[model samples]
Target: MNKEHKIATSMYRKIAIDIAQSVADGKYVEGQKLFGRSVLASQYKVSPETIRKAVYILKDMGILDTEKGSGVEVISVSKAREFVNRYHEIESIHSAQSDIAHWAQKQTQEIADVIQKIQFIVDTAERFKNSSPLTPFEITITKESTVIGKSADELRFWHNTGGTIIAIKRNNDLIVSPGPYATFREGDIFYVIGNDQTYAAIKKLLFE
Candidate 1:
């Protein structure tokens, strides 16, 4: 549920476990009476109702004995130790569940970010396609390509392939309007704009 309510519930459970631990440790022997509810509440800096809840848990687990008029008493150190061990096991399970939930949330956010980036690329492509009759095509330069280390001007790129180079992508960097002086390199992606036959022509010119 909400954080505040969860915290309050945990506090009462923690108080119960602490009291049971004291009994198990022999700090309070069997048959030893505990402080009254009001005194315990004051000592623990909690409301009487919180103390009542803690005492109820201990009594239910056979770690404490209580009567309407008399104060609570330690009844079984063995049961008290058992209660503490059980609480720890349950706590470990809850911790694991929390870790799984956190990881799931982080993965969901990462997926959302990836989707946003893809959508942006799609929208930009649509706008570019609408701006001119010719759509842009991308081609990567490989080490064996004939165009390697050759500038667009030197290769007579536009005259040979009928495609105009608009940009070049080298690793993480984008060189917009890289012009006739931009030299081809292995691993560089060229963004070119041309007619339908331009793609085949560029490929034949670069590789054949």
Candidate 2:
């Protein structure tokens, strides 16, 4: 890899390790507040994105609770230990109970971090897959309605009823925005978009 890429990757890993160790060592004990992204970014001399990435990793490990608007907080040591114990066989593995407990807590946080990372990827893929086109269709509009004529009440009413006017095809032209000021004229074909229910609602509105 290039020098810059290598350095960035190394820095990212270092940041993750530092956060994990801090949580492990009780440097930022359970329930204690951690700085927000902007604050941490300044403190660590890293970009906001870098701080976000690090915080997200910590959050996945269950070591941190990052609530939007509220800021990040260290998870309770007891709770952190509890989670760690579930993923690993802590009780039977060690005779020295205190050391075992400490190790278990740390291990649990690590596992949580891994799971969170994997889950994020899985969720993103699922969303993309679901968004992929499963089918295609052609519709022709037969009405005259302008955004000004239809008004906010009509647009909202349509949206609330699950009917969406996807596009407006005027003479030799296509207007897709269909914004608040948009309009539909007679012979203007509208490309309505939505699922079965939406399609059904459109048919009802048009026919009725």
Candidate 3:
């Protein structure tokens, strides 16, 4: 809300991204201890307060366990994943809570059932996060080839070629599924899922 809050939020967002990336890349894992506050500060070139801000954000997001004397340690990647899934659930609730509640009141039903599904997804994601399964990669797209949202034709082409678009990264936002027929703009990174040949073809299309 205020300037300081805004700054902290921004820093925490970066930290969250970093932590998620680390876990995804297997740099960190469940039960692994994290570096202390001062250590992180020195590594990231941030102030101790900034590091604290980041750490606290991760703590609230359910990624790290912190003790006064012992310092911070990894709890579970599943917990971190759950944190993200729960955040999405909160967003959905914020959008539909009042409307859903009113509808439920009129219908003499409960919204808890729907909310439970959201919770289940969050829980499942958390569980999987902790397990740290190996993810398969298919292709590499650089900052070139004019990355833009794929047209329906392009999507069809990729699909026909046996390539799957799992996710896309546009700055800090992650775009999943039914990509809205969006055209890829520059600076977009897509995570494709498919076999080796599919990946090679896609890479050739993009890079060569």
Largest TM-score belongs to which candidate?
1
lDDT of 3 by residue, 1-208 (tens): 8998887767766766577557645688888888888888888777888888777777876778898899888877876776666666886887798888788796553345445544654454455446744233533345576434456356464665565555555665555553537555667666554555666666656655
Q: For all the candidates, what are their Cα RMSDs to the real structure?
A: 7.5, 24.2, 24.5
Candidate 2 per-residue lDDT, tens place, 1-208, comes to: 8998777666755676576666666777877887778887888888888887777766887778888788898875654555445434643455468777889998898677656644654464455448953212234545422332453245563565454444455675555446655554557665544555666655555445
* Residue 95, model 1: Cα distance from true site in angstroms: 2.6
**Regions more than 4 Å wrong, model 3:** 1-5, 84-208
| Count of clashing pairs, candidate 2 | 7
Question: What TM-score should be assigned to candidate 1?
Answer: 0.56
The clash numbers for all candidates, in the given order, read 0, 7, 8
Task: Pick the winner on lDDT between candidates 1 and 2.
Answer: 1
Q: What TM-score does candidate 3 reach? A: 0.37
Q: Using lDDT as the measure, which candidate wins?
A: 1
In order of TM-score, best first, we have 1, 3, 2
In angstroms, the error of model 3 at 205 is: 47
